[model samples]
Structure formats: C-alpha cells, structure tokens
Target: MPPRPRPRPRVAVVVFPGSNCEQDVAYALNWLGLDSAYVWHGDHSLDGFGAVVLPGGFSYGDYLRCGAIARFSPIMDAVTRFARAGRPVLGICNGFQILAEAHLLPGALLRNAGLKFICRDVALRVEARCDWLDAPTGSVLHLPINHNEGNFVCDSATLDDLRADDRVIVRYCDEEGRTDGVSAPNGALDNIAGITNAARNVFGLMPHPERAVDPTVGGSDGQLVFQSLLQQFTQEVF
Candidate 1:
C-alpha cells in the first residue's frame, strides 16, 4: 500500500483595483505546482488558502502614499487575521508597503534617494532564516526591483528590535553577497531590502521574487521563497 499523497498548497494572491502583478504571482505558484487564485480586495475571508501573497503593483493607483489607501480595504482585515494565525504571508514591493501600513510589519518605504523609478535586477543577500525563506545565510539571490519609493526606513527602536530578533531576512548586496553601504539601492536605511515579523511567518521584501521564477525572465533564484514555504509545510504539517 502506498502512502497518501499530501494535499497541494493553495495560495491566495490578493487583487486590488490597481494591482498588476497578481497574475504574475499566480503564474509563479502554478509553475511550482501549487494551486493559486486571486482574492478580490473585498473578499473578507481567506478561507482555505494555505498561503497569501501581496504581489508588487501600484495598488489603488499609489494614491495617499504607496500602500496607505489599500490598507483599509475590506480584505485586509481578513489578511490580518490570516497572518495572526501564523500562516505564511508574503509581501512584495508595494505589497510590503501595505503590510507596513497594516502594521503587520514595521517601518515605511519612502521615495528613493534618487527620486526616480528604478527597474533592474539586484543581488540580494539572504540574511535571516524566515519561515518562507530557506536559503542559507549569505546566499546571493538575483531578483528584480521596480519602484520609485523603495527606500525602507524605521524608527531607531524598531530598527533595533528587528536586528536583535534576526527578522531582517535579506539585504541588497552585490553579486558576492557583500552587504555594505555601497550596495544599498534606493538608499534604504542600513541597506535593508527585506524583513519578517518576529513570528517569521510574515515576510516582506522590496524585490519582485515572483518575477524571477521563470528562467526566461532572468534566474529562478526567487523560486526559493515559494519552495521554502512548501518545505516548511511538509516538515511541520506532514
């Protein structure tokens, strides 16, 4: 007798009026053999989704700040509840801004120091072991970033806490994975490009990992994130 097959993990990609990356997320998840669907901003419930992703895009036309307006969407309440349940929630680029606005994560993303929209591939150094990231510490991942307001900033106390708890998951670095001031794109404070909540289930990053999942696009380094979530589910729930 063969063992029962594990259930496929279903992911929800939240879609707002102005969201443009939900399809990208869904496609990436599909490539990984996971089931995924878009949840409208008014859905009010996450139900059976095994994971939630806030993909990169100009949500709500980026009005009233990047993610400020989207934070009040009816679905955010459900997202907050889902995150509090220790489920894996990932926020990418503009999604990161929404997570911060909802207070699921700390800090804010401000205008880039250069004051221009940047779109390019960047090297990210995996710095923390978060639930959604299994890359070894110091591994370099190539992910694309496209944003005008990607500079990450937090108050001194919040920064201290994030560092003390090892919640800063990744940092913009060079190809060699050297995280120093010279590698800080958008002039992010302390060169921080990503971080997670103290619980490690809620992760946010400035780079667009979903965009890197297809080999034709660039590299599949970003697939590690989704793969890591699958690994986590197998290890802890199977």
Candidate 2:
C-alpha cells in the first residue's frame, strides 16, 4: 500500500503590539492553502502549532531597541519552549532581531550601514539547504526587504563559528548569484542574508519572504521557503 498521508501542520504567526506583518504572513499561508492563525503576544501557549513565525515590523515601536522589549512578550516564553523542542521557527526582518535578542539564534541586527530605511527587491543565493530552504546551493532568489535595522552583525569568532557549522543559509547576491559587496544592500557582515541554528530548525532572515509569495506582487522565490516547511513537516506525524 502507498504511504499514508499525514495531517498538515498548523503554523502560528506571532503578533506583537507593533507588528504589521502578521496578517500578511497569515494571508500568505492561507493563499497557499496552508493552515495558519494569528497568536496574540499575550498568549502564553502555542500547544497545537507545529511551526511558528515572528513576522516583520517595529515591535513596541522599536523602543530601546528593535526587538529588545518585544523579546519579553508572554508568547515568547512559549516560543522559546517550542524552539527547545526542536520544532521549526522562522523570524523575518524585525522578527530576526527578536530571535537574536531572545538568544534563539546568534548575531544581532544593527542599523543600516547607510543610515536609511531600505525598501526594495534584491537577489539572494541559497548557501545551505536548511529546513526553510529546499533550493539547490547557489540558486538565486529575489525577495523584498524593508527595514532600517536589517544589517546583521556578530563578533569575528561567532562569524567564524557560523561559517564553520554551515549555519549561514543564504547571502545577498547579484542577480547572477555573485556574492559581492555591491549586492549586499545593508552592508551585512559577510553579506549574510539569513541563517539557521546549529540544529537547522530555528531560522532567521531580514528579507520578507511573505511579501514575495504572490505572483501578482512580482516574485515567488519566497514560496519555496514556505513550501519546504509544508513538505518537511507534513510528511511526518507530529
């Protein structure tokens, strides 16, 4: 007999007071026929969700720091617990900053090197086939990024460690997938665009994949990330 199909995993999009991308993420999943729901920041449980997303936008008005205050949200406790269980967790843009702040992932997001908010579609190259990306290495993806503090930074040792462990999942690149300084929009260290934890389950990136999920909007490179999650988790009984 053929292998039995497992139930699709439900995704939860965390929404903080200043999060503006929660609905966009939910819509992206719903548009792709996947199950997803919004979880308020005050909620302390993520019991049934198989995956979680910390979407983009200024949380707590970016007070003190971009994600410094939001890291203490009630839902983050549950998120931290979920991450400890080795489930998939994604952080995009401001969300990436939170992941860094929560220590769920390494490195931190700093102000743009140019000191200006950047909003544009840019080219990216898959550096590793982590849980969030199924694309072949060197494959180019075009995704939109919107933020002022999207520049990623880390100590030299940490950068070396991430490089050694192959945790650098993606890098800003030219349309031809060349990893040159000119292609790096925010002057991120090592042109890093995204990364995954040692376990490869927890992922964070500055670009808004959800915004690029629709063909009508221009690019669909972002869909592969979501599809990879659906394909991976839906195949196993969770």
TM-score of every prediction relative to native? 0.96, 0.96
Clashes in model 1: which pairs? none
TM-score quality measure for candidate 1: 0.96
List lDDT for all candidates, in order. 0.90, 0.91
lDDT of 1 by residue, 13-50 (tens): 99988888899889888888778989999889998888
- Which regions of candidate 1 are displaced past 4 Å? 236-238
C-alpha-based local distance difference test score of model 2: 0.91
Candidate 2 residues lying further than 4 Å off, grouped into runs, are 1-6, 181-183
RMSD to native for every prediction?
A: 1.2, 1.8
Extract clashing residue pairs from model 2. Answer: none
Q: For model 2, how does the per-residue alpha-carbon lDDT over 99-188 read when each residue is reduced to its tens digit?
A: 999999998998999999999999998999888888999899999999999889999999999999999998999888888655478989
